[model samples]
Target: MNVRREGTAAKAAAPTKTSGPPASLREAGAALAGLSAVFLFEMLDNSILNVALPTIGRELSASATVLQWVTGVYAVVFGGLMLALGALADRVGRRKVMLVGLVLLGAASLATAFVTTAEQLIAVRAAMGVAAAMTTPGSLALAFRLFDEDGLRVRATTLISTVGLAGLAIGPTAGGLVLAFAPWQVLLLVNVPVAALAFIGIRRGIPADQASGPHRAPTDRAGALLGTAAIVLALLAPTLFVDAGAASPLPWLAAATAVVAAVLFVARERTARHPLLDLALLARPLVSSGLAFKAAASLATAGLGYLVTLQLQLDWGWTPAHAALGMLPQVVVLIAGGALIGPLITRVGLDGAARLGAAAVVCGLAVYGLLGRFGYGWVALALALVAAGMRVVGVVAGTNVMRGLPADRTTVGAALVDTVGEVTTGIGIAVSGTVLAKLLTGDIATATWSTQQTARFHEAVTRAGLTLTVLAAALVGWGISRARRPGAARTASSPGH
Candidate 1:
């Protein structure tokens, strides 16, 4: 197997000024709009559907387990297929793969109108997950390829992420409002129009792929199978923990399966001639460190969000609507913070910006762990700080990952960044939920809790928050060490580094 160092391959892949005008947000407005829509679907679909689950249950006469699968299956399939499909995109054509995925997304979403059973909806959601796997990595990869300048790449990424973040933040509320007037099916059917818009924009704005010859290496089928099995099992373990509790052997078994698959997958990649993901590329300081930073940010964000939502609704006696409103601080900061990323990256280099953002997330988690029980003010402050941190780290870390890879590998690199975030987010939520289940005696979803139960709930929150804080801090420290290694100074800023 021939493996090129990240620095050498990056230098070879760097685009010159004469390559043509750099694809700025203004110049690539249509493509960016389309890509933003793709991300919006991914972020919005689950959040919005979650709000309508009760309604779906009533409509379909579904049990709780079926309802869980309705959402769980989508995440499992989406996370599992991302890396393999990303490699496929790199080999075949990013634009071609993305367009086909949009078509599938549209068709699957349209099928929502005809679905009558919970099983059918699960099937449709799984199909949508497949579509997401195909399109999401391409969105980032295509956007990175569009821009020749690192600064433009940062700004473009920030813009796309902002749109998706907005969708995530508002999805629940939007779904509730829509359900008030329309059927639950409308929530998913909305994707048809979104897919259509993305399809048109991508077809017109993005250029066609330049084909690689037939002599290109074939994809490593064994690596793809092992990689997908590992991720699917890893993602499944958390949901199993939440549903089956810690004492149940099912979650533990799933966790063991995940670990074994991951080990075997690594061994496969190391030996494969045309590996789905070249493990050596991850040795690059920027690539690995950037992924570490993203994982840290995602872990903190998801855990905090899950814990705080429960705190407000179950423990504090806030209504669902009120709890949603309470989360406004995070949404506000995430949306408004995009303007700050460029200035921050300009002041601090990308690596510095990533470290700063990661530190803020740790601090935010600490605040919640220590002081959140005192008042809503502390909780709000924690939310804003974490949101701000995530905003910065999300853009800079992803850009750094893209910058570290050669042109042909950007899709898979983007997949790696996303896969890290997905897995860590699942772990974070699982850890928090499992801790709460172990500590609290009664049903957590009950409207009224005894003083003892409430106290236990608060303790659970503190323990979970602090645990996540320590883990995130460790990840950030590791990332900082990696970023400071020799040759790490050759960042995207130089363009010709």
Candidate 2:
């Protein structure tokens, strides 16, 4: 890849002339604070509704499957759109696109608060997904762009990622507090002021950067459609067959369409003047493996979060705050893993890091799965294990991708990182949600379950758990074992390689 500067760090520091003199550290701090607020909102919003799932259902009389739409819809749409929007940021100014995203996000949150019916709520969540899709990619891309020093960029990235888990760390507690005094509607409404504050801050504090060249790159319209089609199909396939009473042929047809679209997407990326995404990057083992590891990491973490929240509320009758707060240990270890031990592990190479870390995730999953089969008492201890495992996975996987890419591609790469993460997370939520839904509908309740229904619940949960665990293990091995290729053949500066 041809970079304007080959060094690991950006050469020029922030100019005091363009944006007033707040001092470098002060400026970086403000930028970080801005991102912290915005990033947490983006991250926590994913599962804040999840903690309230059971309570919302009881209040609104939502069906088992419909309740999950609150979380599932947001994930699928947000993840799918990010890939397109990432490219958009590269082509346009990240700041302008960011402000637009913030406005939409704030408005959507307000709209979510007013939603009354299950369908309205689902639609609002999907709208929020779109807002997030636009806002999040630009923000992350800009974080990498704005921070000139590698040390600062790395620290900023760790901070951005850490706060997301921190949001999850407190989401249940916050949701509970909100539900205690106010309707669940207040939960979403809170996002508006936070987003508005962020919007105002970003407009005033952040300076404009150089724009993409005058020659408009062709929008990867077809590729965008294809990518969206694949995710929609993957998420809807099981749900359509199980929930909608759709014909068997319809689900398979959807899957077939996705396969065809993917083929077209790759072909288009290779030939297009301005491709939506560079699919050729997948030829690099580290990049491809990074994507796969990202997917695998989400599956493990999402599954753990999903089951823990459900078990606490549905089985043991814990409060939402209790359920949410109960996950604190997992959060702590995850943060430590990313910030502290990750760099040391990567110093040894990606394979060693992935091997140790991926195995840690499997061991954690197996332990938690076993504990889940019994009762709630074993949770806190088991979660410690889960945290350590997930932390390793996140740290190693992130290092694999971030360190391997060129400095200039940081914007697109960060967005791509988010895209892979969200898509995998969306898939995990959908798959696990499907399993939980089936169990809930059948007879998995602690008090009100028939023998046959109980059997069905176990069967479904077992299937989901086993499938995720197996895939996590296999992908971890595959990702770590593969030979990594050099960074991209085509960099931003190298117009003619």
Candidate 3:
């Protein structure tokens, strides 16, 4: 098997300087808008849809399990196919693949209006998942390619994420409001216009694949299959655990299958010529550490959001509307935190920003575990801290990962970052849910709990929250150690290589 030489790898990773003036976000213009829309759709789709699930169930006469699949299928498909599609984009054309995805998104979303059955809706959602797989990774890769300077990359990423985070923060409330007057189908129909805007902006703003000199490596079909299977099973295992409980053997079987498949995929990649993902590239300090930070942030964010939602509604007896409002501290921090990115980077550098942000996430989780049961103020504080930390690490760590990879591999690298986040988010929620199921003797869905049941619920929340805190802290600690290594700091600071 051939390995990329150290010098060759460095040369490939270095930014190619042009004779013209340096690139800026201003020059990106419509391309940034297009990328932002792509992210917005990814973040908003499920959050908004979750609000309409009960309505969807009632209208379609769907069962509880089927309603869960309406959302679960999208996540499973999207997470599973991202790496394969990202590799395809690198070999083919990122812009071309992205445009095709936009068309599919619009078409599938339009199909919602005609769907009367749960099965049909599920199929439509699965198609949208495919579209998401094709586009989400490229959004970051293309943004990185748009600017030669690391600062510009960070700024561009910050801007794009702000839009996406805004969508995530507003989706539930917006969907609730829209449902008061409009049909649930209208929630999906909104994607049609979003897709159109993205298509127009990308077509006008980005150049064709041939213009930038696309990669010509042969596609690795075996690696793609194995990798897809591994990811799909890994993602599926969490849902099974949440729904099936620990007593069931199905989730364990899925998990073991995922591990075996992942091992096979690694063996294949190590030996295959023109592998879908070059394993050696991932060994680089920046790449691995950046992914760790991203995983930590995602784990904490998803776990905290899930636990807190349950706490407010199920444990504390708050209404859904009130709980949504209760979450404003997090929503506000995530949206308003964009302004802090540039200044934070300016003061601490990317490595510093990531470490600080990661540390803050650990601290926030600890606070929630220790003091969240005391009062709402504690919960709000915990939420704001985690959101602020995630807001920074989400942008900086991703930029660092892109910087560590070769020009041709940026899309795959982005996929890896996203894949880590997706997998860890699932694990985080699984851990929280599994613990609650094991500890709370009463049904969580009951309208009211007995006094003893309530005490057990509080104990479950504390134990689960602390468990997640320890896990997140371990990941952040590993990330910090990786960043502090001899040459990692230099590599992170100097983007030109």
TM-score of 1: 0.94
lDDT of 3 by residue, 1-497 (tens): 13558778889999997644237778788999999999999999999999999999999999999999999999999999999999999889889999999999999999999999999999999999999999999999998888877889899999999999999988988999999999999999999999999999899888777755567899999999999999999999999999999889999999999999999999999999999999997777888889989988999998999899999999899998899889999999999999999999999898899999998898889999999988899999999999999999999999989877878888888989899999999999999999999999967899989999989888988998999999999999888887777867565455443
What TM-score, over all chains together, does every model reach?
A: 0.94, 0.78, 0.94
Candidate 2 per-residue lDDT over residues 173-233, each given as its tens digit? 6787787877888888878987887777677666764654211466778877877776566
* Deviating ranges (above 4 Å) for candidate 2: 1-27, 51-68, 112-123, 212-216, 238-253, 307-328, 335-355, 368-382, 392-396, 399-409, 429-442, 446-466, 483-497
- The sequence of per-residue lDDT tens digits that candidate 1 reaches over residues 296-404 is 9999999999999999988788988899889999999999999999999999878889999999999999999999989999999999999999999999999988888
lDDT of each: 0.91, 0.66, 0.91
Give the range of the ten consecutive residues with the poorest summed lDDT in model 2. Answer: 488-497
Q: Which candidate number maximizes lDDT?
A: 3
Clashing pairs in 2: none
User: Candidate 3: where are CA atoms >4 Å away?
Assistant: 1-22, 489-497
Which run of 10 residues does model 3 get worst, by summed lDDT? Answer: 488-497
List residue ranges in candidate 1 displaced over 4 A. Answer: 1-19, 212-215, 491-497
